[model samples]
Target: MKALTIEPLTRDAFAPFGDVIELQGARQIPINLGTTIRYHDLARIDVTDAGGRAIVNLFRGQPRVLPFEVTMLERHPLGSQAFIPLTDKPYLVVVAAAGELDPEAVRAFVTRGWQGVNYAKGVWHHPLIALDDVSDFIVVDRGGEGHNCDEQALPESLWLTSEGLRGAAG
Candidate 1:
């Protein structure tokens, strides 16, 4: 199995697939009598295509351990999908380009508990890869019309391991 090295999630690195949602380097706005700081426009929510509407979902994911098999990847063709970690623990994201699933194009990223990602329309990605234990995510995506979810198998096997996490930027 080809092993994936987990890289630190950065806006520039992930721009090809989607936006990196985080508080750092975001436009801040003061609201509600200046009691709240808003991190504005962190991501573009593009769920309104083909009579679709934006929707919020709570995705509770079970944890995965190392040497994780990379068998399949999925994508949303109709709109973008965002996963914001509700649990203050690190997680993994595996993604590829927008078109066909190239096993060689697959990349892995590790979030710093506070960061999130918005997968652009049709970008191939693995489902949530929560670590250690059960985790929760606030998912924002399209809710109506057309087949948004598509899953495909990998050409070959790939594995993500603990060593990858250790190599990521802390």
Candidate 2:
């Protein structure tokens, strides 16, 4: 199997797929009598589809060993999903554009310990691949009627190893 190249997560690089939830260049709003600064509009949450409502969840993900095989991808056609890491550990994100899953169009990224991602509706992506330890994430997604998740098996599996990681920013 061929190894995938894992790029460092960046807003520009990840824009085609969805928003990157980070505080680097987010809009700042001073609230709480000027005692708190809010990072406003970090990501767009779109869960209102087919009677679907936005729901918040706490997800604890087990760590995944390196050289992980990516054989399939899933997507939510009805709503978007956002994952905010509660644990300060790097993780892997694999994604393909919304539409038919073309394995060749797949891209991989490695997040900094503080970075998070929001996969837009209909965007194809692999499940969370947490590293180092058991990580927790604040997941915001759709919850209601209608089938949302769709999984597709890749034509061939790709392996993600440590050596494949590119600029894993500290």
Candidate 3:
């Protein structure tokens, strides 16, 4: 059995692996919406497209807490889009790739990397599993319009707990 680790989500920390989309602090910017108001850089956001055509949908809803047995699915030729965690204490389930096609030595690794949005596309990963409540996510993907979407399940099960992430600090 493999123990799951909770990692803190930070821009600098997650930069090595993928784009970290979260507001580090407030930066005032002029509002151009036919009104005069200051806009803050609430979160660092990035957008992805395919052949100048976007295939993603943005939906707003409360964040969903995941179970310990959360398993990841795999995809290829497409990138991933995720939401940045905003709660004071947020947790995420990160899984590494496994199989002969996986060039990495590790097999199905899981740990917490960032509290904000982090995703791996053209890479192997699990489905949506939230760490807190009321998380607003800006989804990025190749748009589920075609048949290129591929998902493969893992044999070994994994788990996540709040106690595990208590000591992680960004």
Candidate 4:
């Protein structure tokens, strides 16, 4: 199997695949008598298709060990999907661009607990890869949809290394 090194998640590096959800360098607006700071419009929630609506749900993700094997990737054709960790634990994100499923285009990102990601519509990505412990995430995605998901099995398996990924920023 081929090996892929996981990189740190950053906004600029992840732009082709999705939006990085973090407060760093984000627009802030104080609201409610200046008691709360609002990070407004951080991610583009593109569920504007007919009969498409946004829905919020809590996802309990099972943790996966290092040197994980990746055999498949999936995409949402109708709407976007966002995953925001609800706990202070690191997680893994694997993604490719929005076109052909080129194995060479695949990239991996390890995120801090406070970070979240919004996968753009038709963006190819692996499912949640929570680590450390059983984690819960606040997921935002489309509800009413025709078959919104498409899965593709890789012709060859890939391996992800957990080491050499810490503290390396994109």
Per-model TM-score, in order, reads: 0.97, 0.97, 0.60, 0.95
Which residues of candidate 4, in runs, are more than 4 Å off? 164-170
Minimum summed lDDT over a 10-residue window in model 1 is located at 161-170
TM-score for candidate 4: 0.95
The TM-score obtained by model 2 is: 0.97
lDDT of 4 at 81: 95
Error of 4 at 62 (Å): 0.6
lDDT of 2 at 114: 82
Per-residue lDDT over 85-163 for candidate 3, one digit per residue giving the tens place of the 0 to 100 score: 4335444545454333232212222224233454555445555555455444456455444444566555555555555
Local accuracy of candidate 4 as per-residue lDDT tens digits, 45-73: 88767689999999999999877999999
Best-to-worst ranking by lDDT: 2, 1, 4, 3
- Writing each residue's lDDT as its tens digit, candidate 1 over 64-99 gives 989799899999999999999887888999999998
**Candidate 1, residue 146: lDDT:** 86
- Candidate 3 Cα outliers beyond 4 Å, as residue runs: 25-52, 59-67, 84-93, 97-120, 132-134, 144-146
Once fitted onto the true fold, the runs of candidate 1 whose alpha carbons sit more than 4 angstroms away are none
**Model 1 Cα displacement at 102 (Å)?**
1.3
lDDT tens per residue, model 2, 55-101: 99999989999879999999999999999998779999999999988
Local error of candidate 1 at residue 110 (angstroms): 0.5
